[model samples]
Target: MRNILVVNGSVSGDASVSRALVEVAVQRLLGINPDASVTHRDLSHGAVPHLTPATVAGVRAVANTDHELSTQALSDELIAELQAADVVVIGAPMHNFSIPSSLRAWFDHVLRRRVTFSYSEAGPKGLLTSKRRHMRSFDPPW
Candidate 1:
């Protein structure tokens, strides 16, 4: 089964233009792929885990004897989903000329070593195929 992860970058809930646009594109893709499964991650709806001292520590720990720091940085569930997803749909909106904080948190979790990316002789290679990235940027649109 192909997994399609739709990342709604809107920090103002689903009502945001970016999320709405992403929803429309996601629905259209679903219409074309009835057998496909979709995971809609709404960042504005409290889905983002805060980056505390422990969380930051965990993300940086590669061989921590304790799981506390690692768990705080990235959850098993999210890492698994991110690694398994066949495609990622990103809704990028400008918030003060930058991506939203919630979206940044999502990136932090998704963009990990030996998971989402890896180093090779040709520089860093994306674990995810370039074709898997379906991005739509707008002037506050998805």
Candidate 2:
């Protein structure tokens, strides 16, 4: 079974354009793939940890469990979800004519150098290869 990670990059809990867009897409995605599963990670619901020195160190220790970092249990869960995705769909809004910060944070969490990408003579390369990439936006013309 395929797992699709749907990241809702809206800052507001209610009346967010990104949330609406993601909802519609999630429904359509469900219709298209009956067997596939969808996981929703809301950028702004209650709270999510900010990527700090402690958090970064925690991520680095995932490979070797002996050397641990942050004691928060959610860090391990978050890292696993990111690495296990079969595809990633981000619902982003142009804040100040640019993508929202949470989406950027999501990238920071997932786009680790050795974990999610590789540096080669040909330059940087993506470690994960998925079938679909859907980035939708709803912002006033700017």
Candidate 3:
């Protein structure tokens, strides 16, 4: 892939095994494609805010207030990043059998209705036609 997006969702930061795994995967990918570029999004540092009514309004393109407008801008930016990337690597350490809240928040921001997907007569249709590779590091809680 020419453009790679590495999203780290582990709150454990440097101590996260999932993050380490992602690093290895990224390095391997880079080794194969020496000219490829990589962009990182660390969600543990409050980079992605949890969804609120304002954020919902923004993602829906009904933003009116300043807060909603700002949230919408963020959502747009995140979606743009996703659209530009050819590969997406996600580090997700199991948090009570689910992904971290920050990662969930990121999903909430990027998975915009009619932007990433749409309803069809048969079923849901995906609008992002570009081929994407997703590598997620899932650590099960024992």
**Top-lDDT structure, candidate number:** 3
Clashes of 2: 0
The global Cα lDDT (0 to 1) of model 2 is 0.65
Candidate 2: minimum summed lDDT over ten consecutive residues — where?
63-72
How well is each residue in 1-142 modelled by candidate 1, as lDDT tens digits?
3778887767665467777777777777777787888987777765666566545555544535455555544555576677677777788789889987888887776667776688999999887664444355434232
Candidate 1 vs candidate 2, TM-score winner: 1
Name the regions of candidate 1 deviating beyond 4 angstroms. 61-74, 134-142
In the range 62-119, model 2's lDDT, one tens digit per residue, is: 5333223542344556656766777667777788888877777666656666766789
Off by over 4 Å in 2: 62-68, 71-76, 133-142
Clashing pairs in 2: none
> Which predicted model would earn the best TM-score?
3
The global Cα lDDT (0 to 1) of model 1 is 0.68
User: Model 2 — TM-score against the truth?
Assistant: 0.73
Which of 1 and 3 is ahead in lDDT? 3
lDDT of 3 by residue, 1-142 (tens): 7988889888886688887788888888899998999999889889789877655798777899998898889889999989998888888788989998899999888887789888899898778889554545444333
Which lDDT values do the candidates have, in the order given?
A: 0.68, 0.65, 0.83
